[model samples]
Target chain A: MAAEQGIDPIHQFRIEPIIPIHIGGLDLSFTNSSLFMVIVLGLACALMILGTSGNALVPGKIQSAAEMSYEFVGNMIKQTAGTEGMRFFPFVFALFMFVIFSNIVGLVPYSFAVTSQIVVTFALAILVIAVVIIYGVMRHGTHFLKLFVPSGVSPLLLPFIVLIEVISFVARPISLSVRLFANMLAGHITLKVFGAFVASLLGAGAFAVIAPLPLAMTVILTGFELLVAVLQAYVFAILTCVYLNDAIHPGH
Target chain B: MATTETAGTEAPGAPHEAAFPPFDPGTFSSTLVWLALTFGALYFIMKRVALPRVEGILQTRGDKIRGDLGAAFKMREEANQAAAAYEKTLAEAKAGSQALAQETRTRVKTEQDAKRKALESELNEKLMTAETLIADKKASAMASVGQIANEAASAIVQHITGKPADMTAIAAAIAAAKV
Candidate 1:
């Protein structure tokens, strides 16, 4: 048996630079995260290109898949943000496809998860909030402030309500980013821990007979992680649409 | 010894430090840059190429469906018009045949009336001719009977005492007897 490495489930999230580059004082380098992002982009592009290449009146399998995803995101935006919000269709669609591809690709044996990093998820969340703020300001101007103050409230309770609303509004990006990051981090860690358990048990020879328990758990957790990956991506996109709705309409 | 050795080699930080790299500030800038590049590229491709094509296909399918429905509706209207026209023609034909039958009946009645008038006139002429012939024959027969009566009276007179009796007297007697 190979030497037993410690049950270090956190080792997978490590960022190793593939091509280290230094610009002035900034350490800008290509990484496994970057490579996986490119892979996700390639897969998304290839699926679209090959799927719609025929553009048959009656669609083939891949064409149906491509159309299904397009309509899925389109309907999500329409439901959450209304028709006017469809102006940001490309942005929402891109975010949905990128997150979904990243989550699914990270499930591959040795692939890195770009969404597992807080910087990426936080950046996406900030981008969504930034769009909402910018669009709200542009569209509603001074009336956008009404989103912070609920209607039908007395002057005495108004201040407290506004404070709570402000706190929740500011916490949108934090919650959005953390929700996805924590889910992926916890799921990957659990899978790795179970996998390490199986490895260690097998290495012990006599306990190898019990390795199937942790192995079975790893398998089940893997299935669960796959579900989480899809669900988290969908949740992220839906939240983005909901946030964007406030910008489009401004008031309640 | 094995646990310590594995821990030392695998993780350089404390046990908690190695678990979460997202809090690490050193790699944040690089990760952000890459994330921006990748997400920007994905957004551009989706907006410019991938999404447009899908939208185009959907638009074309929608247009085709609408056009087919319109064509079908138009064809139905045309069929309805043709059916109306056929019904109109059939009604006209029935009306024309009814008028022709009425004309034939009137013409036949007129001809029969003219023929019946001509036959009655001809039969009246024949009856007049037969009555005139019978009158003429009765007059001639009475004249002959007068002459025969005159001759028989003369013979009887001769056979008796006197030679011949007067014919006028015998005719007068015959005339009186006919009356």
Candidate 2:
């Protein structure tokens, strides 16, 4: 069993620098995660260029796919946030494509899952929260504080309700970042474990007879992992909308 | 802590390092650097390419909608003008038809009056001719009656006195008839 192979799930989160590069006494090591980030960015840029180069009304394949993605994000924003919310459409759309693209690229062989890291997810979530907070305050002035105060509440229950609301408001970024990071990390770890099982079973002489079963399960897990990758990205974007909703329309 | 140490001792290949030491991602700074690079590129694309194209599409769509609405309004105005002109022409035609009918009636009445006057004059001439014939018949009948009486008287005297009456007797009888 690979359990004896001395590779634990937590140990798999190890970071290794691909290239040693330093600037001004900073340990700026280009790691595997950084490599995946570059690849994801390249993918995004390539897709954009290909989708727009033709720009045909009738739509070739790339144009149609791009148009579909654009309309999908546009509709999601409109449905959740309304027409007034379309102002944030570009940000939300870009976030969705970037996260999804990174997750999918991480699935390739010898690739590092950048979204599996807390730093990346936390940074994105914090940025979204900051934007919402700033936008709410700027647009609504001091009344933006009302986001933590439910309207029409009895004075007796107001304090308790406000306390709860404040806690929930503060928990938004933590929950958003953790949800995406945990899903990505757990999914990749599970796939890695199952893949190890299939490889080890096939490598053993007598247990090679049972290798096909684990191999089939590994294949199934791969499909499920792909679905999770896409779903995690979707969940992250939808949470952003929900948080932004609080900013745009305060309180319960 | 002692339990974790014992487990690590039992595990032959496990690292002997402390578990509490937070992972110093020596590459964290590098990740940030790369992320900044990518983020800058994305921001550039958003500001330069993607955002502009999307905005252009929306603006052009809005202009098309406005232009179509304006054209429709102009067409409606033209249609209304055409309708009004058609209505005016129809009214004028009705007025002309009415005037022609009135003139026809007036002319017919005048022609009917002239025919009636001619008929009346012809009837008056026939009535005067009848009256003159009746007066001539009356005068001739009176003269004939006087002659008849004179002839009868002469015949009677000729039978009694075997002689015809004289011209003076005939003249005296005509004068008595007149009285």
Candidate 3:
């Protein structure tokens, strides 16, 4: 346990560059994170492209998956954001696929989780907010500022309510980013810790008897992580739709 | 583990950030770049190729189902029309046959009545001739019976008297007896 660096739960998130490319003071090097991002990209696109390649009227398993994913995102957008919010369907679908694929691909024994990085989640969250802001302002002009003001609040408490609303509005990206990052980071760390516990127990002499306990815990956590992975992706997509809804129809 | 070892061997950028990777600002640029590249590519592929194909498949399936329903409905309607025509033809033929049977019945009845009338008239004519012959026979028989009586009376009287007796008396007696 003293010398095992593999057991360091935080070590798995380390980003070592596979291809170091430096351009204009930016470390645009492709790291393990980037590799896995590409992997996620490949996985997601492959599922979509290959699954639909046959274009079968009666879909095969893979084709059903592809169709289900499309309808899943499509219906999500329609239900949360309404038909008008369909303009952002491509973006929302992309985000959902990326996150879900990243989560799933990361579950591989030695793979790095791209979403565990806060910067990555923050970037995606920022993108959603940026769309909301840019399109909201462009479409509704000053009326978009009405998003901060409640329609039915008494004028006496309006200032406080508006302040709270502004804070909440500003916190959306932070909350959105942190929510996903924290969940992935915590879940992975727990998995790593428990896995190390099992390994450590197996390496121990008499304590090896209880190795099944941690192993079982790891197995259960893995299952839970799979759920979290999918649930988080759903949460991400649905929230994106809700935000896009504001962009399409501002206020109230 | 290979990745972690590789990270350790890489030029240690900073001691502080190296302890925890998520907080490291050093990898932000690369992460962001990759996110943008990958997400942009996904969006592009989905929008341009995959989604549209799926949408097209669903649309085609829907159209095919609707077409099948329409064709079935059309066939059913045609069947109904044919059945109706069959029923009409059957009713028409039934009515025509019934009318024909009625005509045959009336014609046969008329012919039978005419033949019976003819037979009855012939029988009546034969009966009238027979009656007239019987009447003539009776009258002749009556005249013959009177002659036989007159002879029998003359023979008896001649035998008893033993004489040719009085012709005038005899003639007068015979006349009174005839009366």
- Which candidate leads in DockQ? 3
Better of 2 and 3 by DockQ: 3
Candidate 1 structure lDDT: 0.84
lDDT of 2 by residue, A1-252 (tens): 224434355544555568977666565567776778778877776666556566553557765566666677778877787787777877787778778888898777557777887767766787788879988998898889998888899999999999998898789888998988888888877877777776777778999899888778878988988998999988888888877877788756
**Sliding window of 10 residues with minimal summed lDDT for model 1 chain B:** B1-10
Candidate 3 residue lDDT tens string, A62-107: 9999889989999999999999988888889888999999888888
The weakest ten consecutive residues by lDDT in model 2 chain B span B1-10
TM-score computed on alpha carbons, candidate 1: 0.76
DockQ of each: 0.25, 0.12, 0.37
Error of 2 at A61 (Å): 1.8
Worst 10 residues of 2 chain A by lDDT: A1-10
Candidate order by decreasing lDDT: 3, 1, 2
Candidate 3: segments with Cα more than 4 A from true spot: A1-4, B1-17, B119-179
Cα error, candidate 2, residue B41 (Å): 2.3
Task: Indicate the DockQ of the complex predicted as candidate 2.
Answer: 0.12
Error of 1 at B163 (Å): 32
TM-score of each: 0.76, 0.65, 0.83
* B81: Cα error in model 2, Å: 17
